[model samples]
Target chain A: MTTTAQTRAHDAANLGLLPIFMAAAAGLTLLYFTGFAQASVYHDSAHDTRHTLAFPCH
Target chain B: MTTRIFASALFAGLLAGLVAVLLQWSLMEKLILEGEEYETGAKSHFAGVLKLNEDGETAEQAAESGDGGEEEGTTRRFALAFFATFVTWVGWALLMVAGFALTERYGVRITMKDALVWGTAGFGAIHVMTGIGLPPELPGQPAAEIELRQMWWITTAATAVIGFALMGYGRKPFHFAAGIALLIAPHLIGAPRLDDYSGMAPPELSGEYVARSYAVAFISWIVLGLAAGYFWNRLQQPPA
Candidate 1:
């Protein structure tokens, strides 16, 4: 394989680390704001989402 | 190649988002509004003094009277829902594409059929397996502390994903056994739960909520996976 092709393949093979970790961080932030944040500041914003997901909220 | 992958991923994400918005609207929105009524003291599951006294009428009667149907704004709610759905599926699509790329690197055959299986596995890891411990909860339901519940939820998802990865890519007997171990580990640890199930929402409502949530997750993940796979395959084709 040409150097460029090998490099591209190598990058693609390991391509997920950044995206995966970023997704995890974003997921955690959304989960926190939607699921666990203090009621007054966070509850209303996530109300629709929480219900849509059927998460427990009182 | 990079541009193709991103383009496919973006389109798949948007498609999944639209599907999710439609599914949630048709299936879960009413249940949610009803649950909200109960949560906000506009209704009660069991008839009693605790029930809101709109001229001593029941919740259903009060609702029929039009005293309860006056929501502040629905347009805002739907717009937010669409945005959230779009963002979430996009993130999921990116992850899905990355996962496929990783598997391809390890010599696993990538095909549309195989992508469907991957989609199922993704559902299992993110929603089904984790939900085994923490079934969807309704409004006004009591729950374990958020920290503990969140911890268990993340752990379960992580364990399930690793287990699935091993099962798909592992070559040796030891790898297989280890994969099985990973799958079972989270459940053995158990999800955090409330000591008592006391809550304002009725048991029946909670039951329905859990079932519907699982149903939606199953459908959404399947479609999302298939669509992503289809796009990826199409994009990978060489120009004529």
Candidate 2:
């Protein structure tokens, strides 16, 4: 099968300069955002947060 | 004097991204959740409000699934968005410079009209399409729950038709308009239903939101691309 640009991958190009910077920034920023497994609710109300798989769920 | 950049590009790209997310939330999230919310024949159309730490259950009564399998979903989404942002931005920017330079050398010099076209196609079109297929919701939802139901490729055809046309035509403005059309068209067609919360999220909501997101992203990238392209070209130029 002929290789197409859409599916082709280039290791060097894959981590281009802008992406490298953006990812580093985003990762560091995410570390600061703070996420946890759970929080409590007073009355069985639906607003309470729950545990679910990360990104894997959606 | 300092060079000024167009605000339109930045605004458009961010708008596009926002619209894409909103569309998923309003329309597809629920329908997607509805099918997923059902854990058993007897109960749970949705899971809402986890007591957490103490253990709770749902898909039978989600006020908004403040947390559930959706936690997993949200995390994944965050990662995807982060990665998409990082990758697409660099990949497209590089491609854009190459494309523009090629055209200038062979076809025509980069112009505002051309800017709109290519930007829409690259930054706008690709993303909006991916957004359309996403399971709708703000941060939480289920992957298995939001099954594509054999409709996965529905967007593929749309992408090819639109992608190629814009790509093949290759002028700047036409590419831009086509890019906008691809983003806007599905919303106009009405968003996919998010039947999860029963009546909480309205149908067509997902598509509309996605449309706005596309608008924002397109605008933002165009500004970035244009500035970067022009600067790079000048830096590479020899004394004249």
Candidate 3:
């Protein structure tokens, strides 16, 4: 027989597909902003040497 | 293990950054700018050279004759730069995952909810900035693509803010689709191409070029995000 505490721990660990997918999704989401952070390295057409970050939307 | 996770994030970032860089440099430039112009302009395109043929002229002569344009020599440098950028991308992602998770520990939001903010920061802030920044620095500056810049930023920002907000509002089933939409909506709008050399024989083929390029861009973005996510998950179990 499974211990009640063990079962609860297992349930908490799972967090369902939404959380798992979100965790995965979040990685991608953060990439967008950090990718834009690359822009700070590039200032329009005036300067050169961009850091390779991009916001595909922009 | 914690260190390994951190390292993985770094690796992921560098790979992500490098891939993002390459996509921006090779693929993005081609679809948006090169599609309109036949020439690769001041920079280079590895693929565009395929369209060029040099039957009669010397290799150098043909290349100069505007028939052979390839980024042959700079491959090593670009490769190195790509590797470094990829590392940085992972670093950024790791920082985000860890930071957001910590905040959630305080009950700021559920872990899933926090992930949403992380996604916004990634999509909204990072990619656009990088795209706008890097190209000007490469050797042989093309004419400052000013009009294109304005057009890109305005529409891109609008789509990002509105798109992500809606995605966030809707959540769940909306997440993946929203993420994909937010990713592509800007690029699909067609970045301004001056002197584009992709050379659609009939000119109308431009749509095909745009669609093909945007499709590639979406795929790359998705890959970038997935890599970061997998790395983040591996790192999560590291003992603090």
Candidate 4:
């Protein structure tokens, strides 16, 4: 019984799928705006950011 | 645990954002404004061709008039820039902190020094890898289709990140080879390009913009990694 409980605790402590998936989603959302969003939407803002951070957008 | 990580990330993010905004205000803002001036036709690279005024005014007088517009406001631009920088840094900090927790959970030893390395790798994957294909562009610059550029940028950054991960964490020789392959994969499939290179801004302006942009990015990422690591380490420890 103790062994089983310990195993369950270990699994719970492991970094699981949810955080990883959420991070990916957040990353992709940012990426869309930074790299792929329509220029008409936020072109100036993105353009300024691209230059400030030096992301090669040209 | 999540709250602690986020708190650490938010703190680091705010600090990094401040650094980015200050640097941008001091270093890059002028270059961008000049590029815009050319893009909007307020200035011209090619000489000898007079800017014809619909009002039949002198070229110099017309140029002066062109400067006034809905788009012309330093205050607005700076405000927007500050907000964007802050949010962006916060996002990055969250990712960095999460990465630290993930690594720790996976049994890898993490340290402040290691975080610095992580920061460099982040810089490489996010900026250097993608930038290899698409260096910073300025206003009035011609570009290929946005869809294609986006596809390539995502592919490059993804592959680069995977490559770095494998190389850093994989223990086997095959893993190393696989990591190397991933690193080269994006470059092998070159980035999309325009059939022609053209932009209203002068070449010198673009060059300066690219150089300065890289310089600032390199410095900022280093700081971000260090700060994130320091904060995460401090926050995660039990009180004495």
Q: Provide the overall lDDT of each model, using Cα atoms, as 2-decimal numbers.
A: 0.72, 0.39, 0.45, 0.75
Give the per-residue lDDT of model 2 (tens digit) for B71-183.
Answer: 78655654454333433344344445544544443436566656656666555444445445443232233233322421332353245436545655557987867765765
- The best candidate by TM-score is 4
Instruction: Sort by TM-score, best first.
Output: 4, 1, 3, 2
TM-score of each: 0.81, 0.38, 0.40, 0.86
Single out the weakest 10-residue window by summed lDDT for candidate 3 chain B: B134-143
Cα lDDT, model 1, residue B221: 80
lDDT of 4 by residue, B1-240 (tens): 556566877888788878888888888989888987676566778976554434765556775766676465667777776676776777777777777777877768679889899889988988888888888777668788767877888788778878988898889988988988988888888888887876878899899888888777777788888998888888775634
Task: Give the native contact fraction of candidate 4.
Answer: 0.30
Query: Model 3 - which docking category?
Result: incorrect
CAPRI tier of model 4: acceptable
Model 3 DockQ vs. reference: 0.08
Report the lDDT of model 4 for residue B88.
73
**Of 3 and 4, which scores higher on TM-score?**
4
Candidate 2 positional error at A38, Å: 23
Q: Tens-digit lDDT track for model 3 on A1-58?
A: 5698898777555333344345435554544433333363323321111222322222
Candidate 2 overall lDDT versus native? 0.39
State which candidate has the highest lDDT: 4
TM-score of chain B of each: 0.88, 0.42, 0.42, 0.90
Residue A51 C-alpha lDDT in model 1: 59
| Interface DockQ of each model | 0.30, 0.05, 0.08, 0.42
**Model 2 chain A poorest ten-residue lDDT run:** A47-56
Segments of candidate 2 deviating more than 4 angstroms? A1-57, B1-54, B57-87, B101-107, B129-137, B141-212
